[model samples]
Target chain A: MGPQHPSTHGVLRVILKLDGEWIVEAHPDIGYLHRSFEKMGELRTYTNGLPLTDRWDYLCAMTNNLVYSMAVEQLLEVEVPERAQYLRVIVCELNRIASHLVFIGTYGLDLGAQTPFLYCFRDRERILHIFEEICGARLTYSYIYPGGVSGDALPGWLEKVDAFLDYLPPMMREIDQLLTGNEIFILRTRNIGLISPEQAIDWSLSGPMLRASNVNFDLRKESPYQVYDRLDFSVAVAEQGDCLARYHVRVAEIGESIKMVKQCLAQIPDGPTRAKLPKTIKPPAGEVYARVDTPRGELGVYMISDGTDKPYRQKIRGPAFVNLSILSELLPGWKIADAVSILGSIDVVMGEVDR
Target chain B: MSEEEKLENTETSDKPLKPAGKASPGKALAEVTPPDPRLLALAELLQSTFGDAALESVVDRGMVTLVISPGTLLDTCQQLKTDPALSFDYLACLTSIDRQDHLEVAYNLRSLTHKHEFCLKVRLPRDTPEIPTVTSIWKGANWHEREAYDLMGIHFQGHPDLRRILLPDEWEGHPLRKYYVYEPDDVPSEQGPPEHLLIQLEGVE
Candidate 1:
């Protein structure tokens, strides 16, 4: 049994009570990285808080931006320009692909396979480059504004993005060959972390986790937002509700996001990317909730405004937070090695989890 | 696909429950239920069951907000989940707001069976911010409630293993609260090792 260790990601100190190399009980001691990001939002002006949202889910900054912006927009009763909506769709889908790539790479590394990790990051770099082109920075691009995007897409950037999209399929094929069909990979993942559909629903699991359990509930499909209503895609679901099933769902989702991006690029119209927002943004006295399907799950934002520049209260509904709730239920009775695999299957980023 | 099978699915598995007293006498006898009217029925049922406990307020541009009290939180959630007419089986999200004056808890509940959603809120005072845990009903509420407690200093009673989730155990102050002060300390820096330091002539000079 491992003692409480610091480098296990986040401040997650787990005392694993093991018997003969098998985990008997895993007691997780968290709260090492807890920043009250929710309470902080209530203190800052609506615009100032967008950057903080970027920090929460650093991997999928676009989704966080969209969720928070949507909430603020709801409070202010402002409609973003259609062009801005299209831009959001494109960036979000790109972010989804990047996040899925990290998921694939990290899951491989967790299971003692290193080659796929490198291969996945090779693709991730290209996505990061595209993001850098859109916004000057790379890691936490706080580009999505409340009324619209920060600025217009750079000159000839669309052509470069098209080139990237064109080459993504062959790279994805290489990833599949390297990990998906390998016998060892299948054995490690197939039935390792089994949770039933009912269990998933009861736990409020969303995104790939819930889809892996065969509940076809994608917010993109069930509650279409932005340009999702017009996009053609499928909510990838599987009945296994195991590690392998979760992996497959995420893989399939990568393909669907690629498809959505293609359609968005093709149908993107020429118009002003932002609306005429007021200088000092003050929303009416009311509450609003907005949800966007992040790579992890449904990233929701709820804001209460008391007719002021700052919010009365802002609550960020992080998908990782809810998804991690089921970990205690899943870890016991499984081998310690399987615990890492299951954690990977849930696809938690401590930034969002600990936020 | 048989008539009997279709009838059974509609009667037992699909349809939402009928609200007592609210259902008209003539319609109550007829019992003609529509497909997946659970969310609609739930709104009506909640209004009648816990009259003032279920407070509906529009936030922003007509976005529905239903304020629920702490005491009836568990029963309200269970009814939304188990009742076929109002099966809000999926707790999409659970989060909290730290008002220096008061702590606000929000639950985003969705019906996977019916494809509908609604928000539930409960406010607790800052001096004694405590609310019942809904982990018994949704299980997803466990981490969320802990997060609230961790960040906003709200206590979630009956949480199986309630402790600091996002912040360190030894770490002082909740960073999320408005009144949390960020005061820097006056500790002096440790001196560098003498062997590694640059030479300076003092007594010899």
Candidate 2:
């Protein structure tokens, strides 16, 4: 209904044809936040382009940086050090938790549960503090780069993360108690915007959206990148494929991320974080598609290098962009209020969608 | 578990944790590594099925890429999706590239059941970059094809609602094209709201 409506979540305007209170048809009119990052990637060197990735899907900037770096690393044919790989996994998973926390808080606010929103942000702030210690920025941390992370973890940084991890589970339980099993929340979300597994797969729905529909396709488990294969965790899935199921999958995933981060910290080795490379980064002429399982879904960076400092072509397959496309197919036949619930479950950041 | 125990457990696995980069410095990345047998077998199957339509196939960076002629794009995609052995149901990505000489569209397809993925490329002449849409084969191709059409100026023959996606409908010149020049003066100055928007605004109160 708007490019500014709070319930629509960041510059998503949907034109709806309504029959009384029910939507007859819905068309999502996106692209209000297009910055043309691909064009910018063409104009910058490989190292300079890392900051550009931080802008897309700003909620999980670490994973965005990780995927772009992975693509460049593949083209450069460079190996990241063992400790740097572990650091990448730790930060990416922590960012996943932070991003999901935003979803939980905002989704609660969208569904008229204000207390859970406050509780979620309270916990999310602590995670941001941890991120700030590591990267000096809370939101757009270009910490993960090609060949390695920007810097090694400072002394006692691991202890702070461990302390925060211990503090998080109890707070998460408080949020779960506040919203997950509440009668009003269940009434608003259960069976609303139901997507069948077949429909989910055909539409290329990913992350919690696809997993909620019973599709067990997680890029981390299926095709491991960084140190994901070393960390042991389960993919969170729900069979219902409704708004409630999506909520459940995300809540469960936060727990899994916590477990993975714990594993990364426990097994991190003492070594250099950044790899030695030439001053100029010019990857050989080839194309490589590197994908990472972000909090939202698969973030794939398709890069073609012409053996030059600048990329010949770069395309980002943002998961939120693809996941939000199903709104036009799913919105009809539901009431206008249910539209808010459905859109919240999709959890799209317009920066990624419009990029 | 202790750190040493974890290290020992991981080291015992035959498969290494890191996938070593195959390309040597200053060497072409695609030329260094030999094609995987599985990829070769899949390429053979595609070649046997499509004959001359499958122009060339190569394996680079552990991904098999099949370059097909634009004329056989739709039929080849349909077979790729429905074929039991190569049930590429998931269209992971659709990207269009301006190669300066010619326009190319790449389809990154993955089969959920088989857990194997590959790339399908279609080359079109720069003057008339047109190809049949694969929306019938994969519904997710809707926005992807629209995006390719919007940024790269590649026309999809059968896209149901092909329009400018990221850029405005009235915007001229696809910016992703290699030859496109950005003119700062092209930016429209501030003006009154459009007639339709004003009409909608009149009913707000």
Candidate 3:
């Protein structure tokens, strides 16, 4: 149905066998955007590979950077400074908010609601502006690095973030009013793409997809990393595993991210952001699998070091890639129109899917 | 169960409540913390059950890694998933690494109920790397195994629809192999417009 269709969201092609209006079978044909990032990573040094991760999931590049950096840090056994840990948490959560905002906006547009898209982008612009102030790039900020973040927060940068957090809740309410409670949005999404909890777990779904199925698994809560344990928050979950429930889970998570960021700002201590290390980064010969709870799901980085500056192997377990695999299993019985809603709920970015 | 009865029951029990390998009483508490009892128990359980099938087990970086023989990969995975003491239901990640001489596939597994995780590894000869698919045990392994097969040229014996996942089917060599060489000329470049397109342009003119 697409490598180009707007509803498919980023260059995913699905071959479907249809019976009148109902779909008999669906096979997702991905890999149109494969850049072989793993092969490229093996050719570069540990420090040089940070920027390549920015391309994996461009929506939340901060989390991608943080996860890769965590894996390298585990191998190097370097302890990040307290302030840098707080900064990592703040930026990762903010990126989560920005990524979810994109999901909500595009999801509304996919379901035939245009006003919410404009509202979501308006609020998302402020988050991008803050990111630009911190890292000088909006979409692909390689701000988080191994051992620590790239730089410390500027003099008034914390204040700027606080101001944006203050401005976000009201705008989120407006989006909720415009789309979440809309009758047409509910009618299109409520029971359209239902996934049982067992199916969600067996398929290894994560983030909002698994949470919508009532699986209370979040890496931040389960296995805290980067000052997440200090911050108090709740995982957003929904009992019904459907398109509408997934939407609700993401919307609720934006609020939780807001709470976590505010706490980071309040408890942030005055200290150095980057750690002191040798000029060359050559981790000891070993293997480690480090994972972080990204906005989409669990972004795991499995790194193998052979006592060289470059990695022996690096494998990225992208959540969108795994979440999208359930398409063929989920799309068989639904109608063609519902297929759009179901695919949109999965919210896959083809860059990660095909990488 | 009253609180006193619970305390009395614990006190009357024959087995001491102290952890299995307690340090000398003269040693300072901060000097050496003992190994985690849960991890020790898990290691014991795995060692007792798998025995010879489990080649080597090591605890490194706060994670348990069990190297299983290729012949016992599928059966070991089934038991890991179904065994109540070790319910590694979720296949977190599957990765294949090229070691220049031999190929290795690592499976990262986690049990949501127990909140414990481990790594399972299997070594195969580089030329003919093949292992039974674990998708029958955990459905999520379907794409992960396919990815390992696609990028590293590992063959799954009984995958339902094993094909190149992140690479096109016609693509030749697995790019993640240590010996793989990239040839720029291998990529097909676009020739000029097709004959049908040229004829259509002429008709329009």
Residues A106-127, candidate 1, lDDT per residue (tens digit)?
A: 8888787899999999999999
Off by over 4 Å in 3: B1-41, B184-205
The list of candidate 2 runs beyond 4 A from truth reads: B1-37, B184-205
- Give a tens-digit lDDT track for model 2, residues B170-200: 9999999999988443353377555767676
Sorting all predicted structures by TM-score, with the top scorer first, yields 2, 3, 1
lDDT of 3 by residue, A1-355 (tens): 9988999888999999999999999999999999999999999999999999999999999999999998987777566666888899999999999999999999999989998889889888899999999999998999998878989988899999999999999999989999988999999999988999989989999989999998999988876776676677999999999999999999999999999999999988777777766779998798989999999999999999999999999999999999998898999999998999999998888888887
Worst 10 residues of 1 chain A by lDDT: A1-10
| Steric overlap count per candidate | 9, 0, 0
RMSD of each: 10.5, 8.0, 9.5
Residue pairs in collision within model 1: A31-B165, A31-B167, A31-B168, A33-B166, A34-B166, A34-B167, B16-B84, B16-B85, B17-B85
Top DockQ hit: 1
Higher-DockQ candidate of 1 and 3? 1
**TM-score per model over all chains:** 0.85, 0.90, 0.90
CAPRI quality of model 2: acceptable
In DockQ, how does model 1 score against the reference complex? 0.24
Residue A203 lDDT in candidate 3: 93
